[model samples]
Target: MELTNYLGLAAILFAIGSATVLLRRNSIVVFMGIELMLNATNLVLVTFARMHGDITGQLLAFFVMVVAAAEVVVGLAIIITIFRARRSASVDDVNLLQS
Candidate 1:
């Protein structure tokens, strides 16, 4: 496949992820959407690494994966805490930070 094809797929995934984050009210679903976006970015990074014949992009993708994993850990912990507190995981119900 061509590089453009990979880029297009990445773009599509990113768009879907963005839409999910914007349109969903559930915190878990939003978290999944964020993960999807991160994966899409990884795809683009890998594609660029292959196109440029260098390991830098791949290394960056690896770091991104690590960060994403950490994000998942922390995000889930927060979500679980919120659920335990309120018995609900809806983003709309999380207004504690509001002034």
Candidate 2:
């Protein structure tokens, strides 16, 4: 497959993820959208790394994966806390800071 094909797929994935984040109200769904976006970015990085014949992009993708894993840990903890407090996981329901 050509590099452009990979790039196009990545773009599509990113768009879908962005739409999900914008249109969804559930916190967990939004988190999944964010993860999808991150994966799309990783795909682009890997494609570029392959095109350039270098390991840097792949290494960066690995770093992104590590950060994403940490994000999942912290994000899930926060979501679980909110769910326990209100029994709901909707983003609109999380207006704790609104004064």
Candidate 3:
């Protein structure tokens, strides 16, 4: 196919990810949705890089991946800590803003 096809796919994936983030109450699921969104963004970047014949987009995509990896590490650790304390992974149960 074409770049448009890839872009469309990325859009759909992003929409699904957004929906998951909005609707899901589980912390792990929400994190998964965020990761999905990041992957969709990377897909778009790679597609644009291919269309433009430039390395910038690909480099950006790589950077995004690295950031996503770090986020996953930190995010999961926080989630695990919350789960250990609350015994539930529900996002609503997390109230870090509260003292």
- Model 3, range 6-96, lDDT digits (tens) per residue? 9999999999999999999998999999999999999999999999999999999999999999999999999999889889999897778
What's the residue-level lDDT of 94 in candidate 3? 74
Using all chains and alpha carbons, the TM-scores for the candidates as numbered come to 0.94, 0.95, 0.93
Window of ten residues with lowest summed lDDT in model 2:
90-99
Relative to the unseen true structure, what is the C-alpha lDDT of residue 56 in candidate 2, on a scale of 0 to 100? Answer: 99
lDDT of 1 by residue, 1-99 (tens): 689899999999999999999999999999999999999999999999999999999999999999999999999999999999999999999988977
lDDT of 2 by residue, 45-67 (tens): 99999999999999999999999
The residue ranges of model 2 lying beyond 4 angstroms of the native Cα positions read: none
Worst 10 residues of 3 by lDDT: 90-99
The lDDT per prediction is 0.96, 0.97, 0.96
Error of 1 at 40 (Å): 0.3
What value of lDDT does candidate 2 attain over all alpha carbons?
0.97
TM-score, candidate number 3:
0.93
